[model samples]
Target chain A: MVSRRGFLQGGAIGVAGSAIGATSGSLVANALNNTAAETATAKRQLPFYGKHQMGIETPIQAVTNLVAFDLKPETDRSSMLRWMTLLTDDIARLSRGEPVLADPAPELAIGPAGFSAYVGLGKSMFIKLGMESDIPAGFIDLPAFKMDQLEEKFSGGDVVIHVAADDPIALSHATRSLVRDSIPFASVRWTQSGFAHTPGVVKSGVTHRNLMGQIDGTANPQLNSDDFASVVWMDQGPEWAVGGTQMVFRRIAMQLDTWDQLGTKSKEEVIGRKLASGAPLTGTLETDAPDFAARLPNGLSVIPDFAHIRRAAPEAFKERIFRRPFSYEAGISESGSVDVGLLWCSYQANIEEQFLPIQRRLEEFDLLNKWTVPVGSATFFIPKGPEPDSVIAQALFS
Target chain B: MKKIAVLLASVLLLAGCAPAGQVEISDAWVKSGEMSVEGGMTAVYGTITNNTDKEVTFVGGETAIAGLVEVHEMAMIDGEMKMQRIEGGLVIPAGESAVLEPGGNHLMLMQLTGDLMAGDMISVKFDFEGADSITLDSVMAKPAEGGDESYHETEMDMSN
Candidate 1:
């Protein structure tokens, strides 16, 4: 199959190269001289999470939903450095468009800053390097995962790698691979892809959802171009991360069956925007600029006193998120219904800065909050780049 | 039965022979251009001519820029002037020139690459079935904020 990416590339750059050779390589070379996507190398080692990987694990519903890993507590400073390298490598490899690269390092993955330990041993300082070893297992929360099968074709054939390593380093290595490959990925992080639910999001099979369903991210940016950049990518980070963006993968399952049971007006209120274009209640069309000061036909605030979009954008922080999501369906058995929901993904700078505040406010009312709930969740940091750097590659056991 | 069959065949033939058309974007670049940051989705208007001998229909074209591109027919909707993406492509008759001007059947270049002050050409390819496929360089003009295409008639002649 002539891949959509390949087809588009045929129109976007294919014509250029053929035309370039016909004329002179000077023009083509000069145009690509500065582009990150045009100049980056093909493949590189994922710095972190190498030794811990048991290979890409797929979920039952034909969805490679869980990108899980094996991890242990950090022993010393040397272990920390090794873990950091793996973390950075994951980010590097991913940005380049060839994530599932074999050969990730063990000593370099995430066990040093693993958050699971916090849930188990309480606040112990010395046991298992401050990690809570007793916490239950988790995995990524997308339904209908298919390992090695490129799912969907919304933006051509962009892959979403859902990963959860024990430590930040491993997660980082996994993330880097996503970034380097330019493969659009989201990490909820705590759960393994294709694995059973981590006891939280059980109602997934009946309705579409996420951790906080209310149909989260009704106000996402368009993927027409890098329009997502302004809303998602952050500036002023580690120079390596300067060009990168942050991706927030939340497993929010909407209680659609329940949402359908709500009053029509009440349901509309949960999502501040309209069901059609996602425009503010005061307007229409997804791209419509909201008139915050305007009143409805009945004299009420067009966006209402408590709406998600208004709080999310707020004329002030003007913070927005670019969402590239897909629907997942995990079939437990041939007869039983499948676990279906959204692979809720968003990109932005500081998750705490932009996404959390909006979510916190929505969690307050969001009318749809009744049915929606957050289950297995993890936050993986994604760097911006079309390629990995030399500093990030490392051996699996290094 | 024979008469009905003849009538049906005639209708089917008419539908199939509907005019085929194409659009070409020449010397394209974004107007009101500004490089780097803080640029709005500009308007892309150009002259689209139905070059076929038969009266061709200029259907809709899609852009990678906006979430969705519509064939907008600007008119007063509910008291406020509004433009909507026509369900189908713009019907430009064969041998006639349909200038996709601002305030009319113009392309609303939403979610543009940047402030097009320095001349940015949005790559848009329009396919006209059997006739031909022409790619246009849509010039970006931010007629207004959000996604409205009603503008004070200003014509920037972008002729090939």
Candidate 2:
């Protein structure tokens, strides 16, 4: 599978090379000159500008905040344009390791720290702004599943800003800066902060574990590959979404107490993957394809019928989603249970075709459901990235 | 069904520890289990410190809210998570504590008599192998906290 980190490494080099190439010669030779200037600074910086938004395919950061905002009752299209313009300026400065023009805490924004921000729109935003026609055909809210126990707190918002960085200080600063900038046009709807492995805890290229201790993101589409481009980036949506994707943010709460009852062997049977190595029951390595038909002496399937992978994996080749989930631990419930779970985030070219079919299968009868519950949910149409001198969502507003 | 039957019959004993004092519970509380149009389930969590020199086994528990108050565990199985009743008793070693927090090991309250709301206190009796059962009253409150249980709107000003 194409790893997100490897993809960003390649992106960083290309971006740095192009920055130098810009001053050299012909477009093709500037590309050559760009290669000559590969330096330490270039490797550390992720390109701020691209055809697609940066955060979607960027390597998972050490810390992140997924925040949504509801438009103020009197805010209109002009107010939205102003909000986007200011947000665009702030992002451009921060992505380049600088502070916003009028930043109150310039010190907090000193290091870019691999910062990237993705902005998206909700269905309500379209209706309120009288741009319902621009809402992409694939941008509808997720249909309710039988297993969903959604609460309104973590649910709806008109706009979402997914900000992340390798440093918690940088990520936190950016989150505040953006939200502060947004206050005039919108009210805070909800905000969820989460993390993965601290920068160096895991070996490079390894998948991160969820709160449940399962190695996740193993079956994701190869980042920056042709398959990923086709499966995640939009081509048939409104012009604004040409290189964008649909996003789903669901806050799933894990029932850790009940989950503790199972033995290691029983746990293995539930997920069809080994806890220690994250490999399939019929395979020894994490990357080996599962042998679904392999059975035991009693002729039972090696991976049970209701195993999560069996249901989550689709029979149709094109039905797939790029899951980029982050583990969240807000606090403790009144009962002293940990308020922990995955900020279940995913992106795909089309929600109706790529994501729903698989979720439907899991909802029907995945053994995993017994210990995990979906308490919050929302969907957004992430607009394509901004070009230099232009703002995010510019294509849609224009 | 087969798994439950096998687990129920399985009994475990802790080999070492102080043989006196028995098991004790602390910080015991409950979140009012919501029973909206969709059915709901609530849980009880606390610290069970084994005071005796010998290990004590948790066989099960009883409560009036549900027809059955079984001890259940939740963990990642086959890359997916699952919660199941302990067929064999959960063993607590002497001098050590078995902390029942949400998402780990706790009392699974099912078939509630009515919606468990905040300010409500319910009674439950815990059964142990080496000592007599102890009944305690637990208070129910909202899951997590803040206005109407919303995380973002209530916590916007809080630092990440």
Q: Which candidate's lDDT is highest? A: 2
> Using Cα atoms with residue i matched to residue i, what is each candidate's TM-score against the true structure?
0.37, 0.63
**Predicted complex 2: CAPRI docking category:** incorrect
- Candidate 2 residues lying further than 4 Å off, grouped into runs, are A1-43, A333-335, B1-160
Local distance difference test scores for all models? 0.41, 0.75
What digit string (tens of lDDT, one per residue) describes model 2 on residues B1-160?
A: 9655433322111111223576777545565423311134566766678898888888778877665566767655566445566667778998888977555777766656666543334667889998778666432232222112221221222112
- Candidate 2, residue B98: Cα displacement in angstroms equals 65
Question: Share of real interface contacts recovered by each model?
Answer: 0.00, 0.00
lDDT of each residue in A230-318, candidate 1, tens digit only: 55555664443454444455454445556666665665565666664455666666456767788867988867666556555633354
Predicted complex 1: CAPRI docking category: incorrect
Chain A TM-score for each of the predictions: 0.47, 0.87
Question: Every model's Cα RMSD, please?
Answer: 30.5, 28.9
